[model samples]
Target: MTDRRPLVAGNWKMNGLSAAAAELDALAKALADRPAPACDVMIAPPFTLLAPFVAAASGTPIAIGGQDCSHLEPGAHTGDIAAVMLRDIGATSVIVGHSERRQDHHETDDLVRLKAEAAHEAGLVAIVCIGETEPERDRDQTLNVVTTQLAGSVPDAATADNTIIAYEPVWAIGTGRTPTAADVATVHGTIREVLVERFGEDIGNGLRILYGGSVKPANAGELMAVANVDGALVGGASLKAADFDGIIDAYR
Candidate 1:
């Protein structure tokens, strides 16, 4: 197995409010009793809760991040949050090119690349998400779509330390439908191959490639055991402490 460390990140997506602090607190408590976990953990709450969640996670291993950020530097982008702003508020990472953002905002691969570059400029890790929709998969274009997105969305400046590749098939996200273990392995392996070809063996192999889409505790163990599947970018289940803790137990 690769020596790359695993990372389990939660994408709260347009969800959560100040009241979600209790969930964070409970998560912290749940993790406190266990020995140091084998993987890194993070949650990307909505912009409104970033500061408070970061504060609440202090002295805990959990990290807080922003759901999305503007590609441009801080300036006249009304209703847009810049990556630097996220870092300014103690958010160590940012999610870019999520399927929701791609579909809802009509975000293109080139735009995603720019956003990831901005995250690097602000010294924040960019979780670059790439995947195919159900139709694309059904047509056998999964590899083409993901690799193209990987090439276009992930910036040239990306390295293992500053960038993460999350394969989140658009169809499976939040649908409670998951790819078969073999399917997950094949896609992740193809992704790893693409990274190695483009970024070189050392940097590519070192970068952690996470699987996202309908990931829950019941399947967390099975999914995480797949070759080249480093971790998960949980959606719905991450909203609760007990469910998230159950998923984290796979690494524990």
Candidate 2:
């Protein structure tokens, strides 16, 4: 059994507004009386509502994270928030190398590594995402693609404290499709091997490997039960309090 604590993280994407207030309220209430999990719980909301959410989450066990951040710390970069700035705003972590950023903005693994380094430098945990498209999987190159991404995107200084690896199959992001249990185990095990080879057993074994791609309350329990899957990087299902709370309950 893995000693790493499970982490259930909700990615709100570009959605949420004042209407999100109600959702957060529901989340707070749902978890209020419930015992906190042995693992971590976090939510990534749009920058606009981060402060509000952070304030609301204060005194609770929930953590606030950013969906993305600029590689540069602070500068003339337009429409970009830096890792340091995120920490200053009370964000405990940031998601880097998401498939959306890769597809929409054409971000490369090198850029992701730099961003992760920035997050680590600024004292925030960086959730570095890696995944393969459907074509890659069809061609049986899923492992190859993910290995390259894990090597290129993650920084050399990655430690259990400052880094997390999120394996999000690009094909499954919002397609309502998920890989089979065997498939998830294969990929997560492979990732763990890669981490161990590069970072040594102690650091590698301590690092949390999170599974993403169409994760929901329905499948959370089985997925979390799998080997090496220490957490989840939830997408659509995380928007609602009930759904996310259900996902969290899977760890129990």
lDDT per model, in order? 0.93, 0.94
Stretches of candidate 1 exceeding 4 Å from the true structure: none
Question: Relative to the unseen true structure, what is the C-alpha lDDT of residue 159 in candidate 2, on a scale of 0 to 100?
Answer: 96
Please give, for residues 12-61, the per-residue lDDT of candidate 1 as tens digits: 98889789899999999999987777999999999999989989999999
| Number of clashing pairs per prediction, in order | 0, 0
Q: For model 2, what is the alpha-carbon lDDT of residue 66? A: 98
What are the per-residue Cα lDDT tens digits for candidate 2 across 127-213? Answer: 999999999999999999999999999999999999999999999999999999899999999999999999999999999999999
Candidate 1 pairs with clashing backbones: none
Question: What is candidate 1's local distance difference test score?
Answer: 0.93
* Candidate 1, residue 132: lDDT: 96
